[model samples]
Target: MQGRLPNGTLIAVKKLSSKSCQGNKEFINEIGIITCLQHPNLVKLYGCCVDKNQLLLVYEYMENNCLADALFGRSSLKLDWQTRRKICLGIAKGLAFLHEDSAVKIIHRDIKGTNVL
Candidate 1:
């Protein structure tokens, strides 16, 4: 979900999907790992919370939404080759950071269209 802070900072709220059965410990660990990394191509995790036993992640909002939406949505907008190349490069850089450059190496459990923005 997209929302604004009291100070008017735009943000994206990610509520852990019920479909995901990750325990609280794992969730907290993931949050910690994410908070330790910073990259231009990676989404910035602003904060996290366990409110009423529900996990929530606050992140910097992307104005254009996810890559999957741009590729498959009903919108008629078309991306030129240059734009597509940039997106691919960005994804590569982000993945490289997670896999090699970060303090701790990470093996992304899932790589799907909707997961990339």
Candidate 2:
């Protein structure tokens, strides 16, 4: 869902089932890793909240959704080769930053079109 914090920053919140332990861990890990990272291409993670059993990830709203949505959805045809290349480069740079720039090496473990956003 779309929401705004007290500071007036726009955010997109994704709700996940608490029953999936793996999913919850990935969600928490992604939030933790992304919140400490900043990049022009990667989606900016603002903050997150854990309310009892619910997990809320607050991210800067992207005008466009995930890379998978742009690559395979109805709007897929709209992204030209150049745009696709840019996306690929951006994802690579983000990954490089995670591995080389950060103090601690992080293995994304899961990297896919959807996660590229």
lDDT tens per residue, model 2, 1-117 = 988888887889987677866665567776786788876766787877777788877788876667787778845447889988887888889889878887667777789977766
lDDT for model 1, please.
0.84
Q: How does each model score on lDDT?
A: 0.84, 0.77
Which residue pairs does candidate 1 place in steric collision?
A: none
Q: Candidate 2, TM-score vs. the true structure?
A: 0.79
Error of 2 at 35 (Å): 2.0
Clash pairs detected, candidate 2 = none
Model 2 spans > 4 angstroms off:
22-33
**Off by more than 4 A, model 1:** none
Q: Give me candidate 1's TM-score against the actual structure.
A: 0.86
Cα error, residue 116 of model 1, in Å, equals 1.9
lDDT for each residue of candidate 1 in 16-75, tens digit (9 for 90 to 100): 865578887888888998887899988899888875568899999887667787789644
